[model samples]
Target: MPFRKFLGWFKGFFGKKKIIRLGLYGPPNAGKTTLANKISMDWTGEPVGKVSEVPHETREVQKKEKVTVKVGGKTIVMNLLDMPGISTKIDFEEFLQYGFSAEDAKQRAKEATKGVIEAIKWLENVDTALVIMDSTRDPYTQVNITIIGNLEARNIPIIIVANKIDLPESNTKWIEEAFPQHPVINVSGLTGSNVNDLYSAIAKYSK
Candidate 1:
């Protein structure tokens, strides 16, 4: 079946009058913020989250509500939560790029320790999660696997968003093969490509 058609049928079968709680999560620079912004813009018709090129730009979780998504002929209400990027260690590279001294970078990394833990804690409460990944790169990071495994352990449904598929090096098939157990959708946040398919997929799991 065509990917989009499969998603549509999945949504129609499971997405009905459900108040979906979705958590957007990924490693640094994986386009988590971009995906969040696109979903917010598409459903709310406004920017509900910020988009930045730097890693860990979102320090706190941003919540938006009343996101109306039409899936399978039903308009489902969605509560979107945009979370800080999860990283095993403080992004020293990003910190140093900002002109921080080694000592200062170390200190900031220590401070960011709490943020990582908080982000993980937030995941436990979410009903569903979107694991964003950069399609241009191999999806073999420990952080990504940990997040996905934890959610799976808890029986929380997940959808992997292979963001940045429009990039020259993006490879969706490799990602699909890498994570054979989960569903993955190739998306381009910059141009809003495959955004509806993502919404429909999430709506399907929301049921």
Candidate 2:
């Protein structure tokens, strides 16, 4: 090989890598923020966002930058993006069941609608995606399918997270069976169960 060509190859091989933009995506109440918090807390000693039982509590995309994760001798630097939960519909009446006043529910519903659009827009900017699913719930849903389809269409590396495995009703197998084409890791974001498995997967699969 020519000396110039070899020198170029050497620099390229040892060059600084671009930071990955890792987006966490799922339907409402699927524990996206909880998992983001867990990952952030583990690597950066900080939480990404507040988690709430109320659907659409996270009405905007939350970002934690420069989180360095080291697992199994591999290190990856990423900008963790905790996205707003996606949904087919956001009705103010639903919040009433959670004791939200009519006016506040309406306002929340409006903000949530905007959030979903924002998340979809951010899809184009994502380098890798974690499509989180609630293992206790049925894996076959329009929201889940749409999320996966969008990521696949964008040719983004996908890592499915079967979250909430600490719950007795969780069936991680269902998620694996539903999307055999992608990698799945079962973990409990709330309790940190099997989170190491998730970290290893991230190191292996992230772009």
lDDT of 2 by residue, 1-207 (tens): 979447646765898655789999999999999999999999999999999999999999999999999899988889999999999999899999999999999999999999999999998889889999999999899999998998999889999999999999999999999999999999999999999999898888876
Model 1 CA RMSD to the hidden true structure, in angstroms: 6.7
Clashing residue pairs in candidate 1 are none
Off by over 4 Å in 1: 1-18, 91-93, 99-111
Model 1 scores what on Cα lDDT? Answer: 0.81
**TM-score (C-alpha) between model 1 and the true structure:** 0.84
The CA lDDT at 9 in model 2 is: 65
Q: At residue 6, what lDDT does model 1 achieve?
A: 79
Q: Write one digit per residue (lDDT tens) for candidate 1, span 82-189.
A: 878898666666689877798877776765676677789997788789999999888987988999999999888989999997889889987898899999988998
Task: Score residue 172 of candidate 1 by CA lDDT.
Answer: 90
Q: Which ten residues in a row have the lowest lDDT in candidate 2?
A: 4-13
User: lDDT per model, in order?
Assistant: 0.81, 0.93
